[model samples]
Target: MSATLPNGSVLSLATTYGAAIPMTVLTNAAPPVATATAHGLTNGDILEVTSGWLGLDARPARVAGSTTNNFNLEGHDTADTTKYPVGSGLGSVRKVLTWTQISQVMDPATSGGEQRFVNWNYLEDGNASERSKPTNRSAKVLTLKLADDPAQPWNAVLAAADAAGTPRILRLALPGGSFLYYNVYVGFDPEPSLSFNNIMQLTVTLNSAARFIRYAS
Candidate 1:
């Protein structure tokens, strides 16, 4: 015989669940900048510097109504010092993340000419949703690391390999969620004129290209 309680089989119901998996980011977008093993940009993982200058506002577009005016210019203008803005600082250094370091970039059946990486932190270890949820089939994510370099426009990169003047792109999605984007046109910073200052930054004006997501538990 055994002594038992009526509620002995009850189980504790709480929010606790299995450990979440780290979101994986993979891509095959661009040529390896250095070597996968050498630059930590291989096997679908990478660390890159999208900025080339140093300080100024490097993002393509500043947040709407964000009147911080944090933008600044660090050097003197040789052409017209009087016209230079009173508060424009340094720019960004162009950092490139090779193609092998990403899982898969996002792409739509229809498109234009810009290809870039829109989200780097969307899929990571800290986010539970990125690891356990199913990816939305229509999420937009960038295909490669974009350079705000007014010199190396999207046309140049695509033209490098294209004999027919058409651009080719790659697609990949980060597990934690990210944006896939493209460069429409490259030009000087928000400033009125171009200068030799290294502090000038280039910003990527990002727009969604697709809607999709996936989670690994």
Candidate 2:
């Protein structure tokens, strides 16, 4: 007999695996120097930023220079340092989940994208309800059970999300080598329910900012 792993088994280290880290605005120098401690990023690594500055978006930006806690944004300038306020952090940082931190990740699907309508008595409709136009389809909300760990990578990302009001990306590599990616807005520190004998667990609810995409590994 052969044994198989769960389809949703995660296959990446959450600590050292992420596309980008949230950067704290600093100095207001020409080609701003941002702060992200121990970012572990290299020069020329392509980065997509959120509203870290007044005019920044999810545009592809690169790391022109770097230090231990700071990096310079290539070709990005804040002509008036006073106007470009500091402390606006970046988001949409892509990251993976840890095997131990996460107990399970529910499958992704549209929570409620389609709408339905009911026919009136004089409408002469054969059925009680008819399909109405479908609109405002929200992306799937992925729920996860995590063993609360302050040192985990996801916790740091979640802290930035809560403090900066931005979302991050969650990537999952299935057992078959296919990848599932989603932009997740996480809830910071949900109510912890623990017992005197059981392991402490936290329930994290992640709302997908866009539809999940699957790609071959």
Candidate 3:
């Protein structure tokens, strides 16, 4: 068996996005096919999707089975019409063009994303027995503790993202060259923590807008 450490990992934030390509239609299928006239995306291109459907908006997806005018939203399931109504998923998609590394990261903690369930208890059944079904998964939140250095260029990047209040991509690169990418909105405490004999630090929170995407080396 092998183990990987987080010591050599790096975190980066998306800083630039390409021009938005208008998406005309999204089919209700296991993996939704998007229609964009003259879309030049390839099989493995990553796109930030914006849609009228709340479940699909602000989500980052990879392109698959691409054609000149259509591509699949890889791994996205929109087959349930109750959850994703037809004609409500129209929006635009943009390619993430650039990323800026966030340095001086001290400790990173992740929470939530647990599977939630709905429970039911029947009158005929014993009190000890109950039925349960899985519901929607919880969102993941990543909190990063970093040295409070105002001189760092990434500080401005964080501030700008927070001010914009838009969902952007956050990537965590592991030691083995694998990656976990999150679509998130940035927020942070403006005041730094003060402690004697230790360097000042601040906490930045990345609230996920959609499920994280993982890529192998």
Highest TM-score model number: 3
The models' CA-based lDDT, in order, is 0.24, 0.55, 0.88
Candidate 2: which stretches are off by over 4 Å? 1-8, 11-138
Candidate numbers, best TM-score first, in rank order: 3, 2, 1
* Candidate that would win on lDDT: 3
Better of 1 and 2 by lDDT: 2
Write down the RMSD of candidate 1 (Cα, Å).
27.1
Location of the lowest summed lDDT over 10 successive residues in candidate 2: 92-101
lDDT, candidate 2, 25-98, per-residue tens: 45466676767788765675434455555455543345658788777655656557467665553543332323
Q: How do the candidates rank by lDDT, highest first?
A: 3, 2, 1
Q: Model 3 — TM-score against the truth?
A: 0.79
Candidate 1 wrong stretches, greater than 4 Å: 1-155, 158-198, 215-217
Task: Name the candidate, 2 or 3, with the larger TM-score value.
Answer: 3
